[model samples]
Target: MPFTAGRGDASEEQTDVESFEALEPVSEVSEIFIKMDFRSFRGNVA
Candidate 1:
């Protein structure tokens, strides 16, 4: 049971890495959106 639990932890780590890699692009897109929002806010204020 202990070995099985250890194996499960390893698999969970792998899945976490894969999901993080998949989110990289989405994070970039979010950054772009944040910048655009800030620019629009500035324009409106000015």
Candidate 2:
């Protein structure tokens, strides 16, 4: 999903823009991540 952890400077802002740029394509990846075991967030998780 075009995942990124941009840090320092204005990287968070830049990542927001980059995420929008990849929206259509990354949406698919995002959907996959949503269903992935590692990404699942149901209930209390550590």
Candidate 3:
């Protein structure tokens, strides 16, 4: 979270990777919600 001027490009890339990895679980949760919504939608249609 703390970006220092001394670390420069390498630090920035590392931070980017860290942020991406942190979002991995969020992606999984969104997929689960999408599947649940689809199932409910199908139940309503039927």
Candidate 4:
């Protein structure tokens, strides 16, 4: 999705605002990144 400062598509802006409003707070710290092991990473070696 394009994050325009302003004067973008009106529908997209409205949808983004509505989606943000619908979110609720969570108690736990969210995992923003995935944890991986070195061997496991090697398994997907291309």
Clashes of each: 0, 0, 0, 0
State each model's C-alpha RMSD to the native: 7.7, 13.2, 8.2, 11.7
Q: Which ten-residue region of model 2 has the weakest summed lDDT?
A: 21-30
* lDDT per residue as tens, model 2, 1-46: 6765645567554656655644444346556566454465544453
Candidate 3, residues 1-46: lDDT per residue as tens digits? Answer: 9765675557655666655653445346446556455645544553
Candidate 1, poorest ten consecutive residues by summed lDDT: 1-10
Task: Give me the overall lDDT of model 4.
Answer: 0.46
- In candidate 1, the residue pairs with backbone N, CA or C atoms under 3 Å apart (3 or more residues apart, or in different chains) clash, namely none
TM values, all candidates: 0.22, 0.21, 0.22, 0.17
Please list the C-alpha lDDT of all candidates, in the order they appear: 0.52, 0.54, 0.55, 0.46
The residue-by-residue lDDT of candidate 4 on 1-46, one tens digit each, is: 9565865557664666656643555443322112222444554656
lDDT of 1 at 7: 52
Candidate 4 Cα misplacement greater than 4 A, ranges: 1-22, 31-46
Q: Which residue runs does candidate 2 get wrong by more than 4 Å?
A: 1-27, 40-46
Q: Output candidate 4 Cα RMSD.
A: 11.7
- Backbone steric clashes in candidate 2, count: 0
Best by lDDT: 3
**Residue pairs clashing, model 4:** none
Quality of model 3 by C-alpha lDDT: 0.55
Summarize candidate 1's per-residue lDDT along 1-46 as a digit string, tens digits.
3344355446664666655653445346446556455645545552
